[model samples]
Target: MTDTHTPRGLAETYFLCWRRRDFTDLAPHLADEVAFDGPLASVRGREDCLEGLVGLARATTHLEVERRLVDENDVMTWFSLGVGGSEPTPVVNWCHVEDGRIRAIRVAFDPRGILAAG
Candidate 1:
């Protein structure tokens, strides 16, 4: 595994942690004050972000990520999440980093699709 300081390395590490549902491992990659925006709600701060991830993991399975782009301090990842035996939902994740930790994340997915089935 590569060092977590680099953008691509951080993306790989983040994805690995996500796949394992290891929130603790993922925490180190997030800034103390992080901003997360997704289909469900917008959240700020590391605690809120972690809480949201935990809640999401409880409702999701078979989460897989596809790396789209990796630059100096930004990464674009595409993910497919299978929720409660439904079809795998597609999402685009954009992450911005500073000092090896994620400062911001924006996720785009079909909220209607998520809400329709839930």
Candidate 2:
């Protein structure tokens, strides 16, 4: 429920890509030096971020969005992540937008379930 011109909308687009398991459109939305911090790793720069995300996404079976909160250039999206057909793990991604691109993203989630499943 976001217009394509807004930050939330960009995130929604990313989520759509996640649902479809395609990230071909993701790189342009991220800043050249975007930062990504997650339970497993912290990566800087857009290439590394995209690489890490795609690498982890390979194990995903599904992504179900629960909610998204937007405050100016900041957006937080809550979703359920299904890995290897296992029970979904709740995940929250805090995204910071700058210059019409995603500058940073910090993800929060319990890795126990995902790690144990592997």
Candidate 3:
């Protein structure tokens, strides 16, 4: 499904595409000048964000959403990620929406939990 241009819609689309590792589906939900800030690095622009997300998808396995909260143009999602047979690591991502697409995203989590496993 395409992004619905709503805060909740954007969050759902993100997690859906992320779970499937479907960058194609995730692309349209990001604004042209989207920015992503994470524990590892920061990137700006849609292409750059997509590249980073794709690399992250490859490095990890079994991405799952554990909890989520949406308010207007902001969304917070709690996630679980794991590699191989290891335990899932907790991750929290905050997304800011603008013009029906995600304009910015900041993720917080224990880097050692998933980075080393990946």
lDDT of 3 by residue, 26-90 (tens): 78878999999988889999999999887777766678888899888899999887755457878
TM-scores across all candidates?
A: 0.88, 0.92, 0.89
Tens digit per residue, CA lDDT, model 1, 1-118: 4478777777777667666666787787899999999878899999999888778777786687755698779889888977766678898888899987999989998876567667
lDDT of each: 0.81, 0.86, 0.83
Q: Any residue pairs clashing in model 2, and if so which?
A: none
Which residue runs of candidate 3 sit more than 4 Å off their true CA positions?
83-86
Could you list the CA RMSD of all candidates, in the order they appear?
1.6, 1.7, 1.7
User: Considering TM-score, where higher is better, how would the candidates rank from best to worst?
Assistant: 2, 3, 1
Better of 1 and 3 by lDDT: 3
lDDT of 3 at 59: 62
- Give candidate 1 misplaced runs (Cα > 4 Å): none
In model 2, the worst 10-residue window by lDDT is: 1-10
Residue-level lDDT of model 2, residues 5-101, one tens digit each, is 6898889978877766677777788999999998989999989988888877888987889999999999999999988757899999999999889
Candidate 2, RMSD to the unseen true structure: 1.7
TM-score of candidate 1 on Cα atoms, chains taken together = 0.88
Q: What residue runs in model 2 are displaced by over 4 Å at the alpha carbon?
A: 1-3
Top-TM-score candidate index: 2
